[model samples]
Target: MLKSWRRRCRRKTGGMPELTIPSHFLCPISLHLMKDPVTLSTGTTYDRHSIETWIEAGNRTCPVTSQVLRDLEPIPNHAIRKNIQEWCVENGSRGIERIPTPRIPITSTEVSEMLVRVSEASDESRCREFVAKIKQSAKESDRNKRCFVANGSTKVLSAAFAAFSNADETVTVLAEILSAMITLTPVLDEETSSNLSSEHPLQKLVWFLRFGSLSARRNAVLALRSILSFDQFKFEIVVKIEGMVEALIRLINEPICPTTTKASLLSIYYLLKPTENSKGIAITLTEMGLVEKLLEMAVDSDRSVCEKALGVLDRMCSHGEVRERARGNALMIPLLVKKVLRVSGMATEFSVSILLKIVRGDEGEEERAAAAVEALQAGAFQKLLLVLQIGSDEVSKEKVTELLKVMNGYRNRIECVDSLDFKHLRRPF
Candidate 1:
């Protein structure tokens, strides 16, 4: 029976001889042989990657035993790692490769000392060396990033950036500092976020977006997105910053890459989110030609880009000025109609909501009727009916039903053939 099992394993593995992995050598979280095993406070061993991912996802419990973890720190289980290494060596002919020893994760103390070194450096060359070291440590792993955040690295980096940003000679060091700051953004605590959101750091990021390398600009936008997500009050601060909105809009207008484009979209979406202060922001964005840019992106792109572009347009169109801007665009109605039921459900909903807002005519019933006629001419009537027939989420269905009613009156205005030209039409029948 054992031989038979080995033969079956060989067949499945494309002919490598089979060797059983010791049950103890497997991580409870992954059930794969542990590469770098660590012991949690719960006395359970898990692969470092698996446990770190779990902890990073905000789970405080031991994945296997369901016990709350008192200590978030994972102690390396050297014995199990050694045993796994030995087993791999013994099974060398069976194609098992030994796992290399994993580097130790940085501790908060190490990160804090590194920040101090960068701060106390007396010369530009020494500062650049220290900044490069910090950036390298941040790039190494998510765990190091968390360590950096925990040590208030964001505040330190912000101060460092402000000090060095004026010196064109220290441009390399400035870039290095910005790169490290970006990694720490993902895990920033409230204190760090507040420090980074101060006027100097915020302006420096805007500067980078405008003048930095393409890679630097992408990092700058990502850092902004992370910082903005921390609090709603920061939106007021950001909108007031000179060139902040324009920088984000320019990225969408001439994207460095798809990633930068999406980041910019999300950043704008966050800024224009409905709040007491955001109404003016929508008007600002619309005035800056953002409406035209979003329409162009939504007209044709990958599903993700389409969804995000339409989503921002949906939010922006909530304001009267924005709706007017969208209405003036020749492609607005047709683009929204095309996106409906063509992209994902969220895209469909956003497109429908924007259409509903545009055609609702808070401006005047005459304007609303005119827009409905435009949608009808653009084949929105057929698309709405198809959406209802195919089924959709409650929001989309409700909006589509409302649109159908509005456009129903204009149905006769749309020109259609009186009869089928069967002479050229091909039919299976």
Candidate 2:
């Protein structure tokens, strides 16, 4: 009957028949055909994507009814879906295609239940299995991630990590749990921060940095960065942990991967970033030989790594001891000069800040003059001029002017320029 009706309609129009779709088949939100129809608590049906997007935008009221969604869960309108599919099959020649069955979304209840299983597992193997399952579900789609976040997976995983005693199997399970928790960091609440900052979980994260798999190490650094960002007071306690700074420095010194290397650099920056409460962190990091590692990273061709390395170096160079250490490295002055105006604005700012610190050292006038001479030989004099000409932030501009004055005072006093300075002078002409 549908075919004969289509034939008659086509014969009248002399082309494909125009089938009028039922109003009920359209989503109330999108006003398009409901491929995967789901009924909201307000008894209005919308396409799954439409409603999910609506709710994700923080809307609690249904679009059609404007009624409060007491239960945010959307029930699948299976009968309407089946009808839509049948209609498409019947109108196959009318440029309509059947909708495929939608995958059942993981619910918050399921996520909560999974977390419960993860917390209640009896042994390492079972715990590992449940944690892996959670990781898999979280990786499946964005909806599942929202479900995990809504279900408080971050707190549960952090608690699980703290519960484990030190063992190879336990470390393995803890690493997996940490990896899973890393995905749930869309927002870090106070409770989650408290849980992660506690002794056991913090130690486990540090352990992962030193001994976990490559992915685990990367996840650990990212997790630490988030925790530190969420709570700044933890810095004082975190730096005191044994081997915490060393492990991060190792990752920087012997990079596992670009991601892990950058993450470690960022984590270190969070620690050594100049805060009134964090005054000693820079000293501690430099004493652990972080200055040499940062100098090595500053020269990396990857501008991101170079920028972060310079940012940390700038922060550390605020200290007289760190400045002395940096100036001691033959490559440090030249690296800072090369980065100015060459990498990025942030990079140039950090590079200029470090150079300014170098030339303005607190040791003595003799030490400052010697550092100024080194800057001149490193081609910093010309780069400072370019920064002024090319236009930079007011702070960098001022620092560039000061750096040029200091280097100029020493430039006339020095007789020899390094090959780098000679090269720079010839290239621009």
Best by lDDT: 1
Screening candidate 2 with a backbone cut-off below 3 angstroms (N, C-alpha, C), the clashing residue pairs are none
User: Candidate 2 overall Cα lDDT vs. reference?
Assistant: 0.80
Candidate 1, poorest ten consecutive residues by summed lDDT: 414-423
Q: After superposing candidate 1 on the true structure, give the runs of residues whose Cα lies further than 4 Å from its correct spot.
A: 1-32, 39-46, 50-72, 79-96, 115-131, 150-152, 155-171, 185-191, 227-246, 270-289, 315-325, 328-330, 360-368, 378-429
Model 1, span 1-429: residue lDDT tens: 235556666787777655677899988878888898999999999999999999989999999899999999999999999998898888665556778988888887788788899888767788878878877887788788778777778888767876775555666777777777776674445554566676666777888888889878988898787677775445777878888888998898888889788889988888877788789888888888888988888777899999999989888888888888788888888888888788888898898899999988578778788888888777787778888998987877898999788788877877622234356777788
Candidate 2 versus the native: TM-score? Answer: 0.72
Which portions of model 2 show Cα errors greater than 4 Å?
1-35, 41-44, 58-72, 84-99, 116-130, 165-169, 186-190, 230-237, 240-242, 273-296, 300-303, 319-322, 328-330, 364-367, 373-429
What does candidate 2's lDDT look like per residue over 274-346, in tens digits?
6674557788888888888777767654889888888888888888878888878888877787887788999
